[model samples]
Target: MKILIPLDGSAGSLHAVDYVASHRQLFGETPVILLLNVQWKVATGNVKLFINQDTINDYYREQGMLALQPARDVLDAAALPYQYHVSVGTPSDAIAQYACEQGVDQIVMCRQGQGGLQTFLLGSVVTKVLHLAECPVLLVK
Candidate 1:
C-alpha cells in the first residue's frame, strides 16, 4: 500500500512518522511511503512584483525541505525506503492533491499542524484534508 504522510515539523507530525516507522512490518516489502511538506502561498498584490516568482518559489522549497527533516530522520533511522515531495500552497489542499495525483491508498498525518491560531481560524488541516481526500485518511495524535 502507498501511504502519504504530510509533515509540518511539529511534534505531532513527527509522531505520525514514528508510528509508521514502528509499524513498518505491517506494510511489507516495497510499501511506498511519501513524505510531503507544503509551504503556505505568499499573499498576492504589489509586494509580489518586488520579489521574483523564482525567488519566492525557491524560498518556499527551501523551507519545505527543512520542515521534512524530522520525518526524514525517522524514516532513515528505521532504514525504510521512501520518497519525498514539496509544494507551495495551502497545506490541506496540497496534501490532498498530491495524494490523489500519486494514487496513494492512504494518508497518515497529524490531526493538527504547527500553526495553532491559523488552524483555529481556518479550521484544522486534517479536517480539510478529510473532507477533500479521495482515499482514506488516518490522523495521528
Candidate 2:
C-alpha cells in the first residue's frame, strides 16, 4: 500500500506521523510511505521579478525541509522507510495533487485536534483534504 502523510512541523501534523510509524503493521506489510511538505507561494507579483525562479525554488525547498524534518525524525526514530517531497502551493491542494500524482492508496493526516466552535470557525487542512482526495483519508489526532 502507498500511504501519503503531509507534515507541516506542527504538533498536530506530527501526530499523524507518529500514528503511522507506530501502527504501520496494521497495513499488513511494509507499506510505501511518502512524506510531503507544502510551502505557500511567498514571492508574488513584483517579488518574483527581483528573485529568480531558482532562488524562489531554493527558498521553498529550505522552508519545506524545515517543516518536514521533525516528521522525518519521527519516522527515522521508529525505523520507518519513506520518501519525501517538497512543493510550493496551497497545502490542501498540493497534498491532494501529490497523492493523485503518486497514485497513493491512502492519505493519513492530522486533525488539528480541534472541535466544535473552534473547528467550525477555523477551517483546517484535514477537512479540505477529506473533501478533495479521491483516495481514502485517515485522520490522526
Candidate 3:
C-alpha cells in the first residue's frame, strides 16, 4: 500500500507520523510512504513584481524542507524508507492533487483539535483533503 502523509510542522502533524511509525506491521512489508509538505503560495502578482520567480521558488523549497524535517526525523528514527516531496500551493489542494497523480492508496493526516468557533472559522486542511482526495483518508489525532 502507498500511504501519503501531509505535514505542516505542527505537533498535531507529527502525531500522524508517530501513529504510522508505531503501527508498522499493520501496513505490511515495505509499504510505500510519501512525506509531502506544501508551502503556501505567497508570491502573488504584487509580490512577484518585487521578487524573481527563482527567488520565490527557493523560498518555498526552503520552507517546505523545514516543515518536512520533523516528520523525516521521525521516519528515519523508525528506520523506514520513504520518499518526500515539496510543492507550492494551497495545502489541501496540493495534497489532494499529488495523491491523485501518484495513485496513492490512502492519505494519513493529523486533525487540528481546535475549538468549535475556531475550527469553523479557520477551517481545517484535513477536512478539505478528505473532500478532495480520491483515496481513503485516515485522521490521527
Candidate 4:
C-alpha cells in the first residue's frame, strides 16, 4: 500500500502516523509510507522582491522539514522505511496533488490540523482533500 500522511508538526497530525505504525499488518507486504508537509507560501508579492527565490525555497524546505520531523521520528521508532517531501502551496491542494503525482493508493491524515478558528471559519483541509483526492482517505481523528 502506498500510504501518504500529511503532517503539520501538530499533535493531532501525529495521531495518523501512530495509527499507521501500529497497524502496518493491515496494509500487507509492508506498506510504502510517504510523509509530506505543505508550507504556506510566505514570500508573496512584496516579500518575494525583498527575498530571492532561492532563499524562499530554502525557508519552505527548512520549515517543512521541521513540521515533518515528529512524524519521521514516529515512523523511525517503528523501523518503518519511508520517503518524504516538502511542498509550498495550499495544504489541501498540495496534498491532493502530491498524492496524484506519487500515484499513492491511500491518504491517511488527521481530521483536523493546527487550525482552530481558521478551520471553523474557512472549512477544513480534510474536507477539501476528500473532495479533491481521487484515492481513498482514512482519517485518524
Candidate 5:
C-alpha cells in the first residue's frame, strides 16, 4: 500500500507521521511511504522580476527541506523507508495533486484542535484535502 502524509511542520501535522510510523505492522510488509511538504508560492510575478529564478528556487528548496526535517527525522529514527518531495503551490491542492499523481492508497493527516470560528475563517488544509483527495482520508486526532 502506498501512503501519503502531508506535513506542514506543525506538531499536529507530525501526529499523522507518528500515527503511520507507530502502526507499521498494520500496513503489511514494506508499505511505501511518501512524505510531502508544500511550500506556498512565494515568488510571484513582481518578486520574480527582482529575484533570479535560481535564487527563488533555492529559497523554496530551503524552506521545504526545513518543513520536512522533523518528519524525516522521525522516520529515519524508526528505520522506516520512505521518499519525500517538495512542491510549490497551495498546500491542499498540492497534496491532492501529488496523491493523485502517485496513486496513493491512503492519505493520512491531522486536524488542528482549533475552535469553530478560527477553523471556519482559515479553512483548514486537512478539510480541503479530505474533500479533494480521491482515496480514503485518515484523520489522526
Candidate 6:
C-alpha cells in the first residue's frame, strides 16, 4: 500500500509519524511512504514585487526541508524506504493533488499543525483534505 503523510514539523504532525512507526507492521511488507511538506503561498502585492520569485521559492524550499527533517529521521531510523515531496501552495490542495497524482491508497496526517491562530483563521487543512481527496484520509490527533 502507498501511504501519503503531510507533515508541518509540528508535534501533532510528528504524532502521526510516530503512529505509523509504532504500527509499521500493519502496513505490510515494504509499503511505500510519501512525505510531503507544503509551503504557504507568499503574500501578494508590493511586498512580492520587491522579492524575486526565486528568492521566495528558495525560502519556501528551505522551510519545507526543515519541516521534513524529523519525519525523515523517523523513517531513516526504522530503515524504511520512502519518498519525500515539497510544494508551494495551500497545504490541503497540494496534499490532495499529490495523492491523486501518485494514486496513493491513503493519506495520513495530523488533525492540526503549527500555528493555532492560522489554523483557526484558515480552517483545518485536514478538513479541506478530507473533502478534496479521492482516496481515504486518516487523521491522527
Highest-scoring model, TM-score: 4
Q: Judged by lDDT, which candidate is best?
A: 4
lDDT of each residue in 55-138, candidate 6, tens digit only: 998898899999999999999998888899889898989999999999999898888788678988999888899999999988
Winner on lDDT (1 vs 6): 6
What would the per-residue lDDT of candidate 3 be over residues 43-101, giving only the tens digit for each residue?
98799789999999999899889889998999999999999999989888999999999
lDDT of 5 by residue, 61-118 (tens): 8988998899999999999999999999988899999999999999988877333684
- What lDDT, from 0 to 1, does candidate 4 have? 0.93
> Which portions of model 6 show Cα errors greater than 4 Å?
none
lDDT of 4 by residue, 79-136 (tens): 9999999998999999999999999999999997998897888689999999999999
Q: Candidate 2 on 8-70: residue-level lDDT in tens?
A: 767778888888888988887988999999887888889978889899999899988999899
Better of 4 and 6 by TM-score: 4
lDDT of 4 at 60: 91
- In order, what lDDT does every prediction score? 0.87, 0.87, 0.88, 0.93, 0.88, 0.89
Once fitted onto the true fold, the runs of candidate 5 whose alpha carbons sit more than 4 angstroms away are 113-122
Candidate 2 is scored at a TM of 0.89
Q: Give me the runs in candidate 4 sitting further than 4 Å from their true place.
A: none
Residue 22's lDDT in candidate 6: 78
Better of 3 and 6 by lDDT: 6
> Which pairs clash (backbone N, Cα, C closer than 3 Å) in model 2?
none
**CA deviation > 4 Å runs, candidate 1:** none
Worst ten in a row by lDDT for model 3: 113-122
Report the C-alpha displacement of residue 79, candidate 2, in angstroms: 1.5
